[model samples]
Target: MGIFDWKHWVVILIVVVLVFGTKKLKGLGSDIGESIKGFRKAMNDEEKPAEATTPPAATPLNQPTTIDAQAQKVEEPARKD
Candidate 1:
């Protein structure tokens, strides 16, 4: 659904102004502004590295890449039996 109309917005704003005085409201606005700035900086930093870097190819270590070592060992003993 759409947002509430102007009447609801005015009532909410008046309640906020009454609950938090003019000075506190100003401080809250600054705090919210700083948080948004920090979030933007972090998002920009993440985008830069994704374009600049290529990850190394993954390699299977200490075993054949296609066959699981534990499965092979189990089957080997069954074949002998």
Candidate 2:
């Protein structure tokens, strides 16, 4: 025999109704429908590909890297007159 018969289906439905209640079941259905709609839209939108990111070229070994001297200085607060 098949796994699902009319009796089994009815019993499952009754159990679900008892657990979730009618109002919650209605809200669940609406939420599921919205999720499905959003999934479909995202799938369709994926037809257009986004731009690829490229890495920067490496600097020459001979050229020395420049350091900001100002960055090393820690300024002390001035005394009030």
Candidate 3:
């Protein structure tokens, strides 16, 4: 029989469901669907040119900025033989 036969697929499906319970199977199905959706989204994204993407909002030049740093001096304990 050909691999695409309905009987073979039914048997395979039965075996899979038996090995993995219905709840687990449902989660697996959803996970697989999400993965496929993500893959398709990524593929579609690749078709768009980078230049077409929106640029980040510009920060105002007059905004105040902070540059802070702290320096702590520590002395090591004297070694004892």
Task: Report lDDT (CA) for all predictions.
Answer: 0.85, 0.89, 0.94
Q: Between prediction 1 and prediction 2, which has the larger lDDT?
A: 2
**Count: clashes, candidate 3:** 0
Better of 2 and 3 by lDDT: 3
Distance from true location, Cα of 31 in model 1, Å: 0.6
Which candidate's lDDT is highest?
3
Q: List the candidate 2 regions with Cα displacement exceeding 4 Å.
A: 49-81
What tens-digit string does per-residue lDDT give for candidate 3 at 1-81?
786799988999999999998999999999999999999999999999989988888888999888899989999999999
**Residues 2-44, model 1: lDDT tens digits:** 4888888999999999999899999999999999999999999
User: On a 0 to 100 scale, what is the lDDT of residue 76 in model 2?
Assistant: 94
The local distance difference test score of model 1 is 0.85
Per model, state how many residue pairs clash. 0, 0, 0
Candidate 1 vs. truth: CA RMSD? 10.0
As a TM-score, model 2 comes out at: 0.56
Better by TM-score, candidate 2 or 1:
2
